[model samples]
Target chain A: MRATNDTVSSRIEIARAELTPIQFATGLLFAAAIAFVLVFLQEPLAHDAMHNFRHAAGITCH
Target chain B: MIVDYLQRGILAGVVAGLAYGMYMAFVANPLSEYLHDTQHEHGHDEHGHDDHGHGHGHGEHVHEHAEHAVSETTTALVSIGSGALWAIFLGGLFALALYVLEPALPGPDGIKTYVLAGAGFISVSVTPWLVLPPAAPGAEQLYSIESRLAIYVALIALGAVVSAASIAAYRRTATRHPAIGVAAGAVPIAAMLAVVPSITPTVVTHPELSSALVSAYRALAVLSQAAIWVLLAGTFNWLQRRADPATAVDGSHETLTTKQ
Candidate 1:
């Protein structure tokens, strides 16, 4: 039982390591795309977003 | 084996992305636009509002609009383009996660898709929203952007962890006591939600107009996400079933892929 558990755990670890590239690419893809959205639309959208709050209090975000 | 998963993931991701993206283009975009129009007519400041709880995009992009003179078609196309990218990104990641856990997951293609998509919905939308409620055009912004973002990311991570653990726990306990397994499935999410405080309790942007608008906004947000998950799951299942019937692994072969 103990040996079996160790092997299973190791297999899972190996699988995770093997998947690192795919994981990394996916993360990078999402990060870039999201960044693009923010950068591209920030000008007008941010203005409308921040217009009404009193005191311009808290974090000033565009 | 990994290659097989990657192929399936990409294929399903693209198909589902297109479907979800189309829905956004036709259905979601117009809905948000209508809401914006209505809100403006209400005599409240005519600022833009976000669809699907994303406060950033819905606002007016005045400079770009003015400088570019972007027509409605161009705007719609841009929205579709970005929407497709988002769908692809999210769908691919979701597929990868599901494929990774495929070995341990039981059930047929249909069950598996529902579980994966539902858990995803919970992780991505439901859980995070508990902490950082959707921001509208004029909600009182009490928290700093940096702090709010940090906490929001943390909450999202926490939600993902809880969701994964819940799914795993359900899998384990399910074989022993089915009822216990069900309860176990819910325990982690309940605990997490209870422990986490709301990022901002909220201040009414417009006392009279705020309630109705916010309510509609939130409801639409939830509806949009629910539609995405449903469509994604269905589309992925259909593509998988079409590619190779034998490898249809989400649910059992007993049910039709499209039905589930």
Candidate 2:
């Protein structure tokens, strides 16, 4: 019983040690990915593309 | 797995979109309006001397046309929509990368995790500049080269600060105490709130006030944004703690086994 408890406790400690960093790192990566998408989405589509869509819909930038 | 990635990506997108939308509505839009109104009120009245000035006909006509086309609403909508789409796409990529790298990366010391996180943040913020279309010929450049350079520097700085704060907070919380980390994390949020008003110049109709206000506003805005980012970093760190697999027990098995 004592040996079993000791092994379990040691394993928990090891796991805790391992998981914390991974979680933090993963969080950072997630933040970065979100930032990238935001920047890309801001780019203006080509005038030709917008014009085509507008023509299809019977509208214009003017 | 794909569904999970999609869900996470969408969640990230929503969070980013909402945050950016609120900032624009509450902060940026008002500032833009103030600047526009002020510029109109104190604009160059002395330039009406077409009789004395050479080439006045063409110059005055061009200036008048430029002034008429300057609409704040149009710019705001474009900014908001662009922000939302970017967040979604970037969020998806981040989620996918995490899913792949989680297995191979060692997290025992926290350094590798922090580095990866910082890299992710920097890459997403700076990469879009490469593919962005050139500014329209007659349209004043939205992002000046100097401003773009500043943004790149700022993104890297912000990532480093957030990463450091997160790691420190996590380490503090892990050693059976949570107060220090919580307080440290909270500082960034508070700083953001306090700094925004200062950095954001009040739009006044007077030329003399505009320059000073703009300078102050810029400083405050940067500080406020940094604070918000730090707070976000802390919150993410806390979530990571809650999701830590070590502390969670498997209900299916009667015998407790430590699962990595």
Candidate 3:
């Protein structure tokens, strides 16, 4: 049990160190696209579609 | 894997979306409609329009009332539908944040999800609200829409940075000087809450309307937003566990991922 715990912690450290640039970029792109649609899109129809949810989430919609 | 993250995100989104829609339809919608009506009435009074006889016969007025009811139903349905879509998108964002931050986040797997979700709420909702409390319909706007949007976006970025820094600080000192980390995290948020509200004041456009109603709506807004974040985090963590039955048994996320 003691050895298993040590191995688990080390493995976690390895995973932490393994986050590559590609994965980081992919996550960033996905996040940015979603944020734009949900918060920053200003086209009238799109804006209207998201208006109530934006207001509920306190996103500065009129 | 990236696909796994997206799948988990979409699934979590679906759950949060439904809950958000239902909450809006049942709890928040009525208050919003009341505020809308109050604004309409206030506008009519200002314009000196007759309450019942503004260019419509009594029969026409009845017809109009029926039409308004129909439209209200449609509005409620549309709002709920759109709300679900919005929540789903937010869930996608939540998943992506988790993907990026999971390795670096402190605590065990389950606790990490909650921490990320709490940070998300602060980044996206709570911090923006410090500058601009969730406005009930008909609240007077002190800034142009563009200006308000700019400030909101800036505040969200600031909040995200502060949250990330706080997490990093906590992780660095958690075993040694945890109190320092806690203070480091709390002070910025406390300062923002105290200073921002005073700098950016919101005016009540219609004083005659019930203040209680506005307060109720704002309160509900806060609760609903918080609920969505919590649901998204819970659902995401549940899915992660389901994917790794070994972890489900041992509560260890590191074992399977490292092997992969």
> Candidate 2 at B44: error in angstroms?
2.8
Per candidate, the number of residue pairs that clash is 6, 13, 0
* Candidate 3 TM-score versus the reference: 0.76
Best candidate, lDDT: 3
Instruction: Give me the candidate number with maximum TM-score.
Output: 3
Model 3, residue B101: distance off in Å is 0.9
lDDT values, one for every candidate: 0.56, 0.40, 0.68
For B6-98, candidate 3 gives per-residue lDDT tens digits of 689989999999998887787666666766676666554332222232332323221111113235666667678877876898888787667
Summarize candidate 3's per-residue lDDT along A1-62 as a digit string, tens digits: 23234442454454455668787688679767866765555654455544445555556755
Mark the regions of model 2 whose C-alpha exceeds 4 Å error after superposition: A1-62, B45-71, B100-117, B120-216, B219-260
Instruction: Note each model's CA RMSD in angstroms.
Output: 8.6, 12.7, 7.7
| DockQ computed for model 1 against the true two-chain complex using alpha carbons | 0.10
DockQ score of each predicted structure, in the order shown: 0.10, 0.05, 0.23
lDDT (Cα) of model 1: 0.56
Q: How far in Å is the alpha carbon of B137 misplaced in model 3?
A: 1.2
Summarize candidate 2's per-residue lDDT along B86-204 as a digit string, tens digits.
44544555445444443333233133334344445433332221222111111122333345446546544654455446545555564665566556655653453355435543311
